[model samples]
Target: MSFEVGQKVAGKVTGITHFGAFVSLPDNKTGLIHISEISDSYIKDINTVLTVGQEVEVKVLTIAADGKISLSLRQANEQAKPETTGRPKPAFNKENDRNYNKQPQSDQAPRFNKSSAAPSRSSYTPNQNNSPKKEGDFDSLMSGFLKDSEDRLSSLRRNTEGKRGGRGGRRS
Candidate 1:
């Protein structure tokens, strides 16, 4: 039988890998059951849940242009559960909505107040002890650096001049 999207069908688990499981559908076609679709919780090992030749009900999700099929077991279960009931009730439960809207705030640990958080190292804080050097200290540092730079330039100029004189001012 041909498989359609949102249709629950049975397939045999042909192979299981770390990434996902390959299943052979009734129509002799193959589809993949991704590791994430295997269960609702974290799945560290795919082998524990599925094995070769195991029969599984899967819902076809999509068929790619390359002929690859995507299937989901959880969606099949969810869809099947609702169809069993005669009258379709609202999917949403009022109790869940009431709890969601009127839930009391627990006295848990206070959350980090990012709006009133302390300034990071990259941000400027005028009163911070580790702030930039004072104006006088900055001026003194710049003066020392300028003197050292001037000395280096003077030594470089003297060396070039001495070389020029020793070589008769300019090369022939």
Candidate 2:
């Protein structure tokens, strides 16, 4: 069978080295499952999960242009499980899996009174009684912001007005 990236296939562990394990793929092709790809968790010893001549299912993660193959055991197991079909039925643990695909709707009832949790339309109407307040509306916001900016600039200027201003007070 032809192997494609992301396709899971059975392979035989032909040899094991300290670095990784060599697997003979289904079509007489060989691939390496790196020590890091041997499992989902940290692997202190590759022998714990793999043995010479052991048959295992693995996913093809990459096939280099020069024909080098990279496989992953974690991906194969994840793909082996069955997925759900779209049809409402009794509650099942599988429902949890669906959560990964979509976010749940809000559980709280919608507020209709327009007093609590509802945006006050009057606050953003621009020209009507509920228009938003711009800085010029109060004539103070712009002044405050400008004053703060001026104060910071003045402080910075005063700090740099000394002989220790450039290059951290260096003579150069």
Top model by TM-score, which number?
A: 1
TM-score of each: 0.48, 0.47
Error of 1 at 85 (Å): 14
- The digit string of per-residue lDDT tens for model 1 on 35-145 reads 999888899999999999999999999988888899998787776675564777769877867676775467765588788998887775333254565566777868866
Tell me each candidate's RMSD, in Å, in order: 15.6, 11.6
Cα error, residue 3 of model 2, in Å, equals 1.9
Give lDDT per model, in order: 0.82, 0.79
- Candidate 1: regions farther than 4 A off: 82-172
| Clash count for each candidate, listed in order shown | 0, 1
Evaluated at residue 136, the lDDT of candidate 2 is 60
lDDT of 1 at 21: 97
